[model samples]
Target: MADYEERVKLVKEQLRLAIYFAREFMDVLGKEKALEIIEKAWIKYGADNWKGRLQGVPPEDILKVMGEWFKAQEKVRSELKVVEATPERLSIEFTRCPQYDVCQEMGVPEICQKYCDSDYGAATLINPKLKMIRDKELAYGADLCNHCWVMEE
Candidate 1:
């Protein structure tokens, strides 16, 4: 298990990435729109659905899909930033991530949108990582399922 300090450092890094993406994502879709879509993704598909889909597919699929989807949105958003008269709305596939559900539950996604709580200790980080437990709720947090594949960077 990593010490608390290390965990804090990593979380800081992840949050930084989250903020960067959140801004870029919001630049395309306003903050309100982006938050709405991300919340929807967290609701529709999560660890419950994750289990069934992953049964047949290799674990690597998660990382591959997540990374690719993020890249795709990044490209589109970057282009819009460079060009003028852009739509002023981002069409990023918030649901396209192979693991947005997973990220949301874990509270590590680019946005602060709450999720279905299915994404707890589900990640298999090399070191033990802190979880995002609700202050007054314990509805959906579950220990990291060992079965899940590593998430894409």
Candidate 2:
């Protein structure tokens, strides 16, 4: 039989990999929607882990849940829709610090402890309302779905 310690170690490693995958995809996808997916994964992982700990579910069950999420992500990516982005024309918002968050917005904030302070540009199909831009090459796959962030993969 497999040692419990080794199994636990393996589970941690898998979770790390999943997180890495999520970050990579998020960078290319968008910050808003990507955050949502990551948060969902965490919630799912947490729930499954709890089940294993309290309900005697096997560790493999947790791994399986992670695997399913990854699979679904890949499946969706295979059919992603990339559309040509047109320059945004709406009133755009600018961030106080371009480097803190590193947004293209104008005026560099000294502290940059918060979000943008002004309107530099508007949300566009191309520009997107998302704060982060994933894969400059890929037209647009997913957008930030919450709190002015990313949402794909």
Candidate 3:
């Protein structure tokens, strides 16, 4: 298995390729159309990617599952700080994100928002009764990314 640094390098390379293709699509399809396509594609990808992984998770355990998921990611675990965890809610703060860092380095920081929106799709597929909230993001010039998952009443 690759170490965290190697994994981050691979992720950065993938983001670079994505940025390149996005630019090409924008040149041919126009910026607005390209962005629309990118956003929809990522949303579907996020939903499809997490649906099966979260299939059998009970609504009451959703927050725990999400926390575990983040902990499983080496890079995310390094930057993730769990602010609170309970049966009703889980709040986390991430001081850094490789995707946001790469996007900023590439001079297309706004592109990170399209990728960030994928979490909404993931949350919906995970469980309709669960709500995912993100009020701040490093990708959007915030000091940290604050994420909360709550079991809706």
Candidate 4:
């Protein structure tokens, strides 16, 4: 438990630095261009990582594997809550968010727009049929974040 907590803390700290970097880019390049750069980077990076992980897995098994992967990463488990998990979909509500927290701390919570939007690029790389819909986010001044990952037939 202690080790897991430590890992979570480490992950949170790294996320802080990542958002800080995004904020720096925002300062230099402006929001629009910085977001474009970040999104492109995430597309390649997310594709590489997901392709490697999902390799050899059948399309039918992709959602299961992806769900398990998401759960494992959410293991430190502070901000996100699983609302549902099925072969067709995985739904989650983010009640607390390290990214939002860090951005708030830095007084640039909107920086999260660049970071969160990358998820769409990464999800597409996972599977063309896999779609992610997010309705709200704390960074946008919402009460919480709602995310749904659905595997379309």
Instruction: List where candidate 4 sits over 4 angstroms from the true fold.
Output: 1-9, 16-24, 72-76
Clashes of 3: 0
Residue 3 lDDT, candidate 1, scale 0-100: 42
- Predict model 4's lDDT versus the native: 0.76
Between 1 and 4, whose lDDT is larger? 4
TM-score of 1: 0.32
Q: Residue by residue across 1-153, what tens digits does model 2's lDDT show?
A: 234445445544544455456557667887657655554544454444434543543432433343343444434343222222222211112211113322112122211211211111211221233233322211111131111223122
Ranking by TM-score: 3, 4, 1, 2
Tens digits of per-residue lDDT, candidate 4, 1-153, equal 334446446646877776778878989999889878877875787678888988999988887887787787667666657777888898888776666666677676655665677778788878889888998977787899888889888
User: Candidate 1, clashing residue pairs?
Assistant: 28-89, 28-90, 29-90, 121-144, 122-144
Off by over 4 Å in 2: 1-12, 56-153
Q: Rate the local accuracy (lDDT) of all candidates.
A: 0.40, 0.33, 0.78, 0.76
Give the higher-TM-score candidate: 2 or 3. Answer: 3
Model 1 off-target regions past 4 Å?
A: 41-110, 113-153
Q: Is 1 or 2 the stronger prediction by TM-score?
A: 1
- Root-mean-square deviation of every model: 17.9, 19.7, 2.5, 3.0
Query: Considering every candidate listed, which one attains the maximal TM-score?
Result: 3
The total of clashing pairs for model 4 equals 0
Judging by lDDT against the true structure, name the best candidate. 3
**C-alpha displacement of 58 in model 4, angstroms?**
1.5
